[model samples]
Target: MSPNPPSSRALPPLVRIEGVTRRFGDTVALDGVDLDVRAGEFFALLGPSGCGKTTLLRVLAGFETPDSGTVSLDGRDLRGVPAHRRPVNLMFQSYALFPHMSVEKNVAYGLARERLPRAEIRERVAAVLATVGLTAQARRRPHQLSGGQRQRVALARAIVKRPRLLLLDEPLSALDKNVRAEMQLELKRLQLEAGITFLVVTHDQEEAMSLADRIAVLDRGRILQVDTPVELYRHPQGRFVAGFVGSNNIFSGHLLPSGGLDVPGVGVLPAPVGVGSAAGLVAVAVRPESIQVAAADAKGGEGLLHGTVLDVSFHGGSSRIAVTVPALESPVLVTASGPATVTAGTPVALSWDPSSAVLVETEETTWKTGGQAT
Candidate 1:
């Protein structure tokens, strides 16, 4: 068989944000946030509510202006560009479809406003409808269609303008679980087909993890960290990133001389980084999968902590167990490959490789009462 073609890498950024800051009265919405969205790449701004993700999207779409700093697209400053004149389109969370217009008319609305030729407008609308798989429902109104179908119509409308950039503000938040998954795949395919830079804003970590080429995790109007999904998960910069990205078992304690954090129950467990005497408080983060349960005598295992199985949950492919170690205030979650062999109230030895645990800077918002750091 012929060798498969190499997958395409990201091109240079087409949109750039430099020291962007936006404020509403005394409240800062975006605080010196700097970001770049590469050509044809799907980038996501991820954070919880009031984190400035939506504000950044609005800035990019020309719906809002920054109080300080600059917004540029293709190296051109967008300070004076009005929303209607910018070569960008935004798909809102509400789908924002005109209830009075049919699917075909909604998709063609932008082109019609530009006063395009009659035949050309119809051709472009038909093309975008086909791309979003909405051609069959072209005559249906927004109320007549399902949530996912309405979303596709919105996407078709956004792309019909042939803009260089696309902005999506929680476009999939309204759909059900199954439809959300389907739309995620469809959106990825559409971005690849259109070759336009896509910037999405979402608080849903799973959506950002699944769809983004690179994610910018924001907090309180500041960009905390930006990296690929796997890098963000495997090596979080701090306690917030670790806890926000996925489930983690965190321990808070002082670093001991033996290159481990001295938790009450876990003792001196090996850590990924060395903490000198200068660092007073430290937190250790380890994914549930990194934890292992053995029969009290696993060879070559150091820093073994003995705990009793407090609870067990079967989650189809894997089993999750909450084990409570003596001297620890909270239970540590452990994941096993198959069904849970250990029952609640059973004694078990909980151990993990020293390399699996990541040492992070302690934050006040870390998990309370947990032996591990959040």
Candidate 2:
């Protein structure tokens, strides 16, 4: 499957959150947050702890009420809806499966709660189990199943009722690295096949990038930016997002007369397009993989920044090289494919396409915090 959701902007949103605010005594959990989850869209709330992502998820599931603002599903205000009354299912981080019950029984538990017919429950349970590739494990208890299997069972249980929306909190946190990778693909497939709007809350950036069609980056109970993963990574609007979403070689400088950024130690580097004259400090984030490293003695004058190789580590198909330059406070990280021929203390030259860099303003005035500003 493609790594993005299909364009469906003309369609109405399935979930809408506007001016939502929730607080915990002295602390604000959500600050005037606004968002839209399109129908059949895989959306993610991504941020660090205490960012109010989980709190917002709870609000959607009817487990928590906003102190102010409104939340609606399909244009219907969900003001007084209780957790059990909402047409949404929340799959917790723990999976929360019944230890003694078999997978099939666990999957059918939700259906039974609605007092559905036994044959229909069996049919739905079996169908979902097959969809999740867990038909063979249908009779296995929670303890007898693997971490990934148990997760699938939890998912099956949540989806068996065929809720209009699915809320997953750290859904793959319990699985191992290999299994987690596998489940990422499975989750995406299931979301598409079931045609359910999924709103997942995760602290893992890669998880959000890989799974969501659009991601809302949250901080301190505020939604900072909501965009597709590629857009968030390639074109972050501010310093926090540039540093948060991915590794970047950041340099704080001021705009030069020629529209370039005069980095203190690295000299003037080409500024990204659309970065008009901003009076204050401007920070540029250059992706590690976008940089080209060559021997210092190489015949390149323009667009070249010299540095000393501090370290290099091989990571399967790619190698991460740390280079210490004169002006930058931190060593710039460059990801070069294959093995690195450079050694520690070796002089190196780095060059990148001018367009590869992204301009981000660091002025406090533009900084978004406390969910008060978007």
Candidate 3:
């Protein structure tokens, strides 16, 4: 088996979820879920909507009781603890700032509810406001501040309690594209400075990849894969993860005995040499950026798949080229960093190193030794 990318941090898990199950009537929102979040490392539970990420988050928050299994924080069991009693804070996507109150007041409300001293509350609020870069706008109401600033207010309010774990539910969904991108960086920085374990639930792959040190991909009601961002993109273990995490050109074929994938019409695609007797049907996933494409003069043959360039889209730093191969059902997507030389409707040749292609199986099958999976 190939080695996976090392996690950035290897501290002990601050939050441990074991055999957790939640159901609403006949619908099972979470099914025997297990996960561990390292101390002070930013983590994300990522999946599509209704994938049970929210239910897991609610379970941790004590809002939804699990049907079975146990949840522990800092080695302490949280079976019957109430939401407010737990050492965790949840920041909603809505920001949910009090419209009538100023930014400082909104943040200070949580502390005031706990009946903290006046001097201590003033000092902590000032410090957290400064940390989130909202000191100048402390007195300004949420209605008076920008979207990003209001988000900071909500975050500051959550972290003000110095909670051991901070849960963020679709934290950036409210912001526009540009502002959301900016806040991603801000959120990462805040997590580091606050020195708290931040576990965010987001359906956005980009957000999870960019913000979290490690991410758990949830599907249906089960955890599909938990890995670092780079590892998840570079080495997806199964067909579902390959299709879900990023754009992949997947080719379904049978594993050849001679260490190659046998597509019915495409001949044998190269797999790693010395692959043992593992055979049968499998899917090969090649990332768009991994494949190389160039214009073909006459009909480039020999270890190359000839195709017609269908589309070339320039996206700032790179251009995405789509080529339709005669034997393939889907276009072979390729990414080029330089200028877009090949125009649409031009003849092209698609080729990539054997190492660039990954042999992927369904979620239920064992990993086969071939292609990149080797």
Instruction: Return the TM-score for each candidate structure.
Output: 0.90, 0.93, 0.93
lDDT of 1 by residue, 1-374 (tens): 01111232435568889999999999999999998877777888999999999999999999899999999998999998999989999999998899999999999988998999999999999999999998899999999999999999999999999999999999999999999999998998898898877889999898888888888999999999988888888888877888888888888776776676776544676674554353556778889999988644322343377777889999999999998776677788898998998888877888787788887566545344347523
- Per residue, candidate 2 scores C-alpha lDDT tens digits across 269-293 of 7676567566766677788999898
Candidate 1 Cα misplacement greater than 4 A, ranges:
1-10, 256-258, 264-266, 273-278, 295-303, 362-374
Regions of candidate 2 where Cα sits further than 4 Å from its true position? 1-3, 297-303, 362-374
Instruction: Measure candidate 1: CA RMSD.
Output: 3.9
Evaluate model 2: give its TM-score.
0.93
Model 2 is weakest, by summed lDDT over 10 consecutive residues, at 365-374
Task: Give candidate 3 misplaced runs (Cα > 4 Å).
Answer: 1-10, 274-277, 297-303, 362-374
The whole-model lDDT of each prediction reads 0.84, 0.85, 0.84
Instruction: Tell me the TM-score of model 3.
Output: 0.93
lDDT of 3 by residue, 192-257 (tens): 899988999999988898998888999989998999898898888777788788788787667676
Residue pairs in steric clash, candidate 3?
A: none
